[model samples]
Target chain A: MKHLSKVALLVAGVALAACSQPHLDGSGTGTGSGLGEAGSASDPTSVAYFNETIGDRVLFEVDQSTLSEQGRLVVLAQANWLLANSDFTAVIEGHADEQGTREYNLALGARRAAAVQELLVSQGVASNRLKTVSYGKERPLEVCSQEACYAQNRRSVTVLTAGLSS
Target chain B: MKKLAASLLIGLCAFGAMAQLAKAQSGPLRIEITDGVIEPLPYAVPDLVAETPGSNQIAKDMARVIAADLNGTGLFREIPAKAHISTITHFGSPVQFADWKAINAQALITGGVSVSGNELEVKFRVFDVFAGQELGNGLRFKGTTDGWRRMAHKVADAVYSRITGEGGYFDSRVVFVSETGPKNDRKKRLAIMDYDGANLQYLTDSSSIVLAPRFSPTGDRVLYTSYETGFPQVYVLNVGSAQRRVLSNQSGTMSFAPRFSPDGKSVVMSVTEGGNTDLYKMAIGGGKRVRLTSTPSIETAPSFSPDGSQIVFESDRSGSPQLYIMSANGGEAKRISFGQGRYGTPVWSPRGDLIAFTKQNKGRFHIGVMRTDGSDERLLTASFLDEGPTWAPNGRVIMFTRETRGSDGVSALYSVDVSGRNLKRVEVTGGGSDPAWSPLQ
Candidate 1:
């Protein structure tokens, strides 16, 4: 009985170890160890792959689209990945903080996305491969009225879609 | 020097006297006229006249509601019916000017109601309660008993216009999203009502979420957002027929917050495709979408300048959400808002001199006005959350959504003047948001 119990414990340990390993995709940056890096791709159907490169989307100051240095670096890296994965297409969603008029924010969101689109195109990503839209204070990642949440809400998100390569 | 000073003082007094004379002549019904002062006329609404025994209650209620709507704006003050010494129920009846003047009432409103079969006939007259003369001819409105409240509002509008020398907003309506349930699963429906929150009508059932219903300039149609297709999209609804059609169907995308151009021929909205939210302009009839912004930053809330030659919107491209202006054809947008705080919901004033917007600063949201180019930003009201400003027909007042952080946390409707005066709560049966004021009728 003691020998059988020892074997069962060894088998369970191996199973747990295998489950804990972070799976990397073709980009090779997916092994983030669950920190600020890309999360493991366990669910093949999940759209969380877009969140891999940019841990969270780049948030903007109120009524602004100029990417911060960190945001620029993230976009640059995203552009590089898109260039390498030639079959990939992305929709960059521009968002505004919950301030200003709804109509004005829509236009401002478009400007922000256009700014990112221009940058990506300059980096050699095909213009047709990317699309943009603005939510204009409608869809907020955070619901609080505080500035911190508003800051997180003002963002341009790049959603990656599969099946382009196949 | 003495002669010059005397002349100046005399000249000032004469000018003041002339101003008073002009005010008196401006209307036969002069209420709340003060020397050297120009303001919204103060008026008094007496209980309406009832034709039949049963009609009495309805008439009184309708009059009270109308009075409340007018008084809520802080523009008109209703003299308590108790203070009214004499009630002039007929147009031909001689108004007791001395009695009204004694009570310091400026304008007087008296109405009579008669029920003929299924039709209700309302005869109303506005008097210069102080001047002892009728401002205009007695007006008659005939409708069904169900429209008694609307008739009362129509009477109020007539009084408002005759006294203020501006078109009346009382006859108009407001389209808003009514909220219920919890924050995460809040059920929203498209609702419209008379400006006073009467005549409550729900255009869309609470099957899916709706947001930001905007009225067309003519008040015949409405544009709003719906999540019926599992994604937020813009839809146009005919006010009279309750007919609705989708404005955009770019599959697997979200498009919302639609506003009509000045002529009401085109719609400018935010369309989210591929996770990027940008502004796009499309014809009201729905064809040929033109992309307004090609940036990766948020560009939403597109509003046309009064002339439709330019557009103003809020963008976060500059690291924060600020106001920007661009040509109507979409090129070379310039940032106009340089205030210390964040600005959104930039609405161009109908008069073309100012743009009204909601400003968030230091943890408080304020409804404010700025010049067309973003200069002269003035914060009107500050609270936990004051947003979604809709301009009064005259552009003198702004109605907006004010959400006070209650112990349970709820939001309501509130209106304030563009000058930061006369803040009043708009009473609705339920919580309201995204109020769109209609043009003057």
Candidate 2:
């Protein structure tokens, strides 16, 4: 019964997300294939379009917020996507696996978010357009205790917000 | 608090003038409750007598609640009331010590209740069955009928104090974050309730996520982190008014892991800016901020010593999270945790004797404690996920958050005594975490 309810909840959430999902016209195949300057939105891009289509999150290793080469490549693509799409502002939401202390994880999450935000800025994205927040291990992409899920749980997600414009 | 009850008990025994019998204990089976595992002391509690006619049900229920509070401690094993060889009916009747002893009941409790309109009164006494004498003078608590449970707690407190020579936490409360919904997008709010998870009162709505609530010394105010403004910041809540405001809203900064200073005049919290998190102290009434640490590595979770002269916090300057101690005014900090695991959230015990923290090692989390100077380290619990240890106001038990492993993982509050006994899950409404024990009321 518990398993059934959890499955039902997941289906409901996915259906809602698919309903808002737009057509993918860019070179992005929706498969975080690590391609740069991916996912253009209707000859343009919105914040949601950047996140949902181009993949706004990047994963990290255990306790290490320093971006690996692949992580840097993904962020560079993210930076290019943001530079191409000007009206969109991104807030990098940092998170960690559920293996460390709550406070340390909070700081670790902050470090992860900061790493992403700095990469975007160094790539010429305006610093004013980037904000950061750390949910730590309080929020996780996966809930299992194994290493496989832990890898997915440690991530920095660029959550876009509607800026001073409409 | 002890003086208040001591003075009241003295008043109750004045009329009896049975001075020698009052303090007499000739042959009671003494339980010292050492550091090692020991058997629980067996005891029994009979239904309390209803002095007033309409209070029989209330009296009976109060006895059960009192018994549960004591049994929940894991130090006492309650012999079921049904196992009693003798039943208590009269409020002033002498205890049948031989009957209790026959049932292996080392201690016995009897109580009486009187209810009139919205008012209720409870009086109870503990007896050492083996010794055949009342352990202490009877204690009577008077309050509104709505507060009968509190009255019951008072009775349990008196009994616990008389038996253990240590004060009871029955009358205390805990403030924690009540969690619900899915793990990915969980809803959380600040809640206050009795120590046993009774009388739950939500202090904040679920619209914004809240975490790590710490109570002021007076128990009337709470400091917690909220995401109301789209980022985590410390908020001070007036528990009575159910109103709260940002305690720190420094632009472009995220702050969390707040704790009240012993004096309750200031708060010590962690503020993260440009990836660097550090500990800072600010007046509760809103004033100048004092930088307590200047480390480039993560430094947060600052707890003030009971004397308000020093602070215990966690820092990762040594490449892993470790406990550190420094002066309240801020300066060089000496590393304290030399263990193999990483230690964080080092909260100074209210008694000023030890510091409780969450240690992570060998892919397991444990709630552990060490002396203020970092000696006598003992891990009280081990699990897949257990963190955030908050000391009971008496500093005898540590409550923490435990999240089970799996996709359907849930976070719940749990408690264990400092001696590593009485490990029990705290019953709360739905999933709860980050439990902070309130000082005794």
Highest TM-score: give the candidate number: 2
Every model's DockQ: 0.07, 0.23
Model 2 clashes, total count: 0
- Per-residue alpha-carbon lDDT of candidate 1 for residues A14-131, written as tens digits (9 for 90 to 100): 0111112111222322111122322354543234544753432676766567788888888887787777767667767777765555555665666677677878889999887876
lDDT per residue for candidate 2 within B216-304, as digits (tens), equals: 99988899999898789999988877778999998779999999888899999999999999989999998887888887899988999
User: What does candidate 2 score on TM?
Assistant: 0.88
Please give the distance, in angstroms, between residue B157's alpha carbon in candidate 2 and its true position after superposition: 1.1
Best-fitting candidate, scored by DockQ: 2
What are the iRMS values of all candidates?
A: 27.5, 14.6
- Isolated chain B TM-score per model: 0.86, 0.94
Cα error of candidate 2 at position B182, Å = 2.2
Question: How far is B167's C-alpha from truth in model 1 (Å)?
Answer: 1.6
Best by lDDT: 2
Q: Model 2 segments beyond 4 Å from truth? A: A1-49, A52-55, B1-29
DockQ of 2: 0.23
